[model samples]
Structures are given as C-alpha cells and as structure tokens.
Target: MTLMRQETEEIPAAVARLLSSAPETIAPVAAAFRAFDPHVVVTIARGSSDHAAYFLKYAIELVLGLPVASQGPSIASIFGAPMKMGHAAALAVSQSGASADIVAMAKTARAGGALTAALVNTVPSPLADSCAYTLDIAAGEEQAVAATKSYVNSIVAGLSLIAYWANDKPLKTALANLPEQLEKAEALDWSFMLETVSNAQSLYTLGRGPTMAIAAEAALKCKETSVLHAEAYSSAEMLHGPVSLVNRDFPVIAFAARDAAEDSIVEIINGVIPKNPHCYISSDKSADAIQLPFIATGHPLTDALALIVPFYRFVEQLSLHRGLDPDKPAALKKVTVTR
Candidate 1:
C-alpha cells in the first residue's frame, strides 16, 4: 500500500497539461469559427460525455446568456426529414468519437445553418469529421472502465471553448493558474472523509449558480471512483422532496459560492448539518474546506473541473483500501449502450 504513489498526483497534472493544450491543439478551430455568432446551442452525447456537455451548456448560457439545449432524437434523428436543426450551435461530446448518433447530430447542426464543434478526447473519430471545428482533449488512453482522465480533460476542453468564444483574458489567466491549485489540493490529506464518507451506502450533493452544473460532475466522480451511490440536485430542487433523505449517517456535500446568495446557501448547509449526516462543504471563499478560489467562470470552472481530482484521489484510495478493484466496478463498462 503505497497509496500516494498511485496515479493520484498525475491525474491533476495530466488534466492541467490537457487544458493548456487547447491553445496549440485547437488553434485551427479558433480561426475557423471566428465568424459565426451562434445563438442557440445544442449538445449530443452519452454518459460522462453528455454530463460534461450539460455543464458546458450551463457555462455558456450562464456567462453569455445565450440559449442552449440538449438536442434529442426529434431534431437529431429527423435530420433533413422535415424537422431541422434550425440555426443552432451543435456540440458533439464524445470520448471515442465513434458514436454514430452524435456524429449525425453534428452534421444536422451544420445542415441546419448552425456552426458545429466537436469536443472530443480522440482526435480523428467520426464525430470530428462531421464538425467543422474540433478541440482535441488529448487525455491519452484511459484504461479504467469508468472515466478519470477523460472526464476532467473534457471539462477543461469545454471551458477552453467558452473562454475562447468570449475572448476572455481573465479566463485564460485563471486557467493558467488553476493547475498549481489542483496540485496543492491533490497532495493534501482527506483522512477525515474516509472515516466520514467512504463506507456510506448513499450520498447527496447540492449546489446552486455555477456550482449547480459542477454538482453533476461531483456526483459522477463519486460514483465512478468510490462506488458509493451518490446523487446531485440543484439546490432549489433538493427542497422539493430529496431533503427528506437527510440523516446522521449519510454524507452530504454542499457547494456554495462567495456571492449575494452566500447567506442563503450557508443557511441551507446549516439546515442539512443538523440532520446528523456527516457533511462537507466547498467554496472558493471557505476557510475550512477545500478552497479553489472559484474565480467566476474563467478560473473557477477550470478550478471546479480540478475539484474532481481531489475527490477522485480520495475515493480511489478508499476503493483499494476497502479491498475493492476500482479499475473494474461490477456491472459497469466505460462505454454504455442504449436503444
């Protein structure tokens, strides 16, 4: 058990390198899409890729306030068959670039007069061919059945796309500084979490604002790495019914921001804490927990993207410590199929 020696440290470093890769890897794309001021954005993918795409939609709309939607079979499958993509930006998110449905949607997006882009881990997949512009994540070969490297890489790549589109100098600077923060976070100890969260059979995470999208990533990483069942809900949605799950043993992670709503968000955390379940909180402003200095959309998304690395390291270590093979969780595969 040399746990620290595992790929834990390399995870953040590799993701950092991938984030900076966009300047060089996607320069051609930068030149290609300079003219299109796309209004409607639609995304297509499956599993983790799709999850990252949802995060992207939120990021783009949140910062730019442009409308974005996830393109389903109605517009995607019909293609030129009476139903059209209708002047929207289409993003095909795929790890392998082999998913035909994603490829077709990218083409349909182009056909419908919307500029299309491919956010992918693989450089030369079919999905890339359909999109006029592409950002290659360069995550390398992800050997695990559930994604680790590729998921973070995808988030970074998506951030780069939004940053580039907005010509955001602050975003570029923030991303440059994000890697070191993640390195520091990875090296830190999380012994408290193992005793508090590892053995738990179920967990819940909540976030609002930009963190609302980040919650999805946190939930996915929790499941993939530790195999502890976890669910993510928008902060508002949790009050609807999910709040009833609170108990002393269950762990809850609340994501709050340093904003006008900070008081309300903290109140929510306080309300959840007395429910007795162990709780962890994260914010760029918090003094006690992991602080990424969430710098709005620019550096924060990059930092938020890095947020998963520490959790991954903790969960992966817990998996091995518990005599479970994290590389192969039962009944799960890297790529899933659906009809």
Candidate 2:
C-alpha cells in the first residue's frame, strides 16, 4: 500500500487523538482567545496548511462573527513590511513547524501585539516557538508528501479551539462525534468518481460556505496526487464566468454539506448538468447530477470537514490508477521550508 493510502486510513484515529488531548493542548489557546477578544483574526499558512486555515476562517466568521483575513507571509519575509496587528489575533497552521516564512510572519504578528497561536504537528519547531501559544495537532509523523491526515488534523485542531473559545455546546457535541463520522466517511466509496476523474485531464470542484475550503483542498489533492488539473469555484460564483469552461467532456464535482448552502448548490449543479452531463454532487437534493454519498456530522462546520476523508481515499486510488506515486509527488518534499 502507498504511504498516502495508509495515512489517509489513519485519519480517524489521528483526529481522535487530537480530540482526546484537547483539554491539555487546545483549551489554553481557547482561553487566550476569549481573553484577547480581538476584533479581527488573521491566518498565516501556505499550501495544504493554508487550506486548513481557510476552513477555520469560515468557522471563525460564521460562529464568532469576527472578520478573518489571510496574511501573506511574503509581506513580512520578502518585502519586510510591518503590519498593524495590535487589534487582531493570528492563527498559524502548519504540519511541520519549520517554514521560515511562516515563522517570520508569526514573530511579526507577535511583535505587533496580536494574540498569536499556532496549530502544528511538530511541537518544538521554530513556528511553534515563534507563537505566543501552540496547540499540537497530534497527527503524528506524516510520511506522505501529499499530506492526508495532517491536513485533516490541522482543521480539527482549529475547530476544537473555536468550539472552546465560543463556548458553543452544539459544535462541541458534533466534534466529539466526528471521529466516528470520519470512520464512516473513510468507508464510503467515491470510486463512482474514479473513472470520470481518471479519463479527464482537468475538472472543476464546487462548494459554498465552509465547504468551499473543502473544494479547494480537493482541487489541490488532484494536482498533488494524480497530476490532474482542477480548479475550485464557489457555487455562487460559478455562473459568472467559470461556467463557460464546462462542456460535455468536462467533469465537475460539487461538495455540499447538510447546511443552508445545499439547496443553492443543488440548483447550481442542475444548471450545469445541461452544459455538462458529467457532473456529480455530494448532496442528495440534486435532481439530475449524480449524487455522491456523504456522512452528515450533524453540524454545519463538521459536516463540511467530513467530506475530505472520502475524497482523500478516492484520490489515492486515482493516483494509482494513473500509474503515479501519491506518496512521492514530483518536485515536492515532506516539509517545505520556504523563505
């Protein structure tokens, strides 16, 4: 078995380990967030870790009503620009806490008086040391260069901290049940997409709200594992310009969680079906598009996060189908330290 597949299979257990250690690892950061109560939140990350931060950006905005923005590491590392982060809080997500640019930005945020925190797998690394607070994601050593469990656990860790900070009981309950839901998600067969994706050189992924982040991650996995070209677009934005790219041969996958955006996603999928017959969606509400099975995690936040596990499983097989190595993608390293 490929290391990517093995790490993908270990997602549920990795998340469970993160949740089990939440009180000791994540609660303090939550307490700091509550006390700081910044008007804005800024996220610092890149690649898959940036996708995790994107997921948390929605969660923070939706639940806490605080505006979240992505801070480019280059602003600090490359251009040496100082940021006015005194009234903001910063969260940095990374699997390896060794990225020079990420660590530099974290230090800049801290020096500017932001309540800075890090969600990282490597505990004592530079990024962790640069932050005022650190929550170890506890995803263990991820061997796959494509990054399966570490990405999931980074979002899970951020969600746990958000749950604690907002004192959201319903979200906490949903997170408590997420590991089991992830197991069910991992068992689901997305092979329904294997043939379609394997035949196509490029495709589109669609989602709304929190699931938009999932769509972004899905598109990245397609590029990293199968060497396929994929772009993610919000369902709300699909009809504007990107929909013109759709044709009979083009494949589309829309990820819709059991949230307010489901109906809108279904409508968008139905609209695309006439232009392209090879459209598939995760929700059962769609009329003509093929429906992919999804495990509903009983909360909108977690429901969005759960969709990635099955996609991870599918993309691993898709890489093997294309006679590519998912574990060792071309021109990529396990830990990317960019400055």
Candidate 3:
C-alpha cells in the first residue's frame, strides 16, 4: 500500500489521540484565549495547513463572533512590515513547525503584542519555540509527500481549542463523538463520483463557509497526488464567472454539509445539473444532481471535517488509477521551508 493511503487511514486514530490528550495539550491554550479576549484573530499558514486555518476562520467568526484574517508570511519575511496586532490573537498552523517564513511571521505577531499560539506536530521546532503556547497535534511521523493525518489532526486540535475557548456545548459534544463519526466517514464509498472525474484532466470543486476549506484541501491533494487540474471556489462565487466554464462533460463536485449553507450549495448544484450532467453533491437534501454519501457529525464544524476522509480515500485510488504515486509526488518534500 502507498504511504499516502496508509496515512489517510491513520486519520481517525491521530485525531483520537489528540482528543484524548486535549486537557494536557489544549487546556492551557484555551485558558490563554479566554484571558486575551482579543478583538481579532489572525491565522498564519501555507498549503494544506492554510486550509486548516481557513476552516477555523469560519468557526471562529460564527461561534465566537470575532473576525479572523489570514496573514501572508511574505509581509514579514519579504517586506519586513510592522503589524499593529496589540488587540488581537494569532493562530499558526504548521505540520513541521520548521517553515522559516511561518516562524518569522509568528515572531512578528508576538512582538506586535498578539498572543500567539502554534498547532504543530513537532514539539521543539523553531515555530513552537517562538510561540507562547504550542499545542502539539501528536500526529507522529507523516511519511507521505501528500499530507493526510497531519492535516486532519491540525484542524482537530484547532477545533478542540475553539470549543474550549468559546464554551460552545454543541461544538464540544460534536468533537467528543468525532472519532466514531470519522470512522464511519472513512468507510463510505465516494467511488460514486470517481468514475466522473478519474478520466477528466480538470474539474471544479464547490463549497461554501467552512466546507469551502475542505474543497480547497481536496483540490490541492488532487493536483499533488494525481496531477489532475482541479480548482475550488465558493458556491456563490462560482456563479459569477467560473460557471461559464461548465459543460455537460465537465466534472463538478459540490461539498455540502448539514449546515445552514447546505440548501444554498444544493441550489447551485441543482441549477448546474441541466448544463452539467456530471455534477455531484453531498447533503441530506435531495437535489437533481448525484448525491454523495456523507456522515453528519451533528455539528456544522465537525461535519465539514468529516466530509474530507472519504474524498481522501477516493483521491488515493484515483491517483493510482492515473499511474501516479500519491506517496511521492514529483518536486515536493514533506517539510517545505520557504521564506
């Protein structure tokens, strides 16, 4: 088996380990968040880790009613700009904790008076050392060039911290039951949509709110592992210009969770169904397009994360079918240290 597939299967266990150690690993960060009570939150990350931060963006905004923004690492690493974040908090998500630009930006956020925390797999790396609170994802060694467990664990750790900080009972309960839900998610067969996109050279992935981040992560994995050209856009954003690219044979996948945004996403999928017969969607609601099975985690946040596991399984097989190695994508490394 490819290391990517093996690591993808390890997602549930990795998340459970992080959840089991939450008190020791995440409580202090939650305490810090409560004390800071910042007016704004900034996220620092890149690649798959950036997608985790994007998921947290909706969670923090909707649950905590605080605005969240993503900061480009180049602002500090290249422009050497000064930031006024004295009334804000920063969350840096990194698997390796070794990226020079990410570490530099975290240091900059700290110097500017933001209470900075890092969710990282490596405990004693530079990014962790630079932050005031370092929450280890506890994902262990990830061998594949395409990340699986680390990406899932990063969001799990972030959600755990958010649940504790916001004191949201629903989100906390959903997170507590997430391991079982994730296992069910893994067992789902997303091959229903595979036959549509496996042979296509390019496709479009659609989602809104938190699940848009999942779509973005999925699109990145498709390119890295399978070399398929995929693009992700918000359900609302797609209709503006991107929808023009859709045709009967063009594959479209819509990621809709059991959240308030489900109907809106489904509407987009239904509207496009007549033009594009290859469209597929995931939701409890019935739509004209093909419906993909999804495990509802009882909360919007957890449901969003759960949608990705089955997609991961599908993409791994798709990569193999396309004569590609998901474990060793060309011109990529496990830890990308860029400035």
Q: Which lDDT values do the candidates have, in the order given?
A: 0.68, 0.93, 0.91
lDDT of 1 by residue, 1-339 (tens): 333235455666766777766777765564555456665778887777877887787778766677878877335554434335545677888888876667766776787777788888777878888887887877776667666667667767777777776777777777667667667767655556776677678888777755666577678767765677889987777778888987877788776654444456555666776675476766543344333323332354554555556666666777776677777777877655332
* Count of clashes, each model: 3, 0, 0
What ordering of candidates by TM-score runs from best to worst? 2, 3, 1
RMSD, each candidate, Å?
A: 3.5, 0.7, 0.9
In TM-score terms, candidate 1 sits at 0.85
Residue 30, model 2: lDDT of 95
Q: lDDT per residue, candidate 2, 246-306, as tens digits?
A: 9987899999999999999999999999998899999989779998999988999889999
- lDDT at 114 for candidate 2? 95
Number of the predicted model whose TM-score against the real structure is largest: 2
List the pairs of residues colliding in candidate 2: none
Which candidate model has the greater TM-score, 1 or 3? Answer: 3
Ranked by TM-score, the better of candidates 1 and 2 is 2
Measure candidate 1: CA RMSD.
3.5
- Residue 114's lDDT within candidate 3 is 98
The weakest ten consecutive residues by lDDT in model 1 span 289-298
Ranking by lDDT: 2, 3, 1
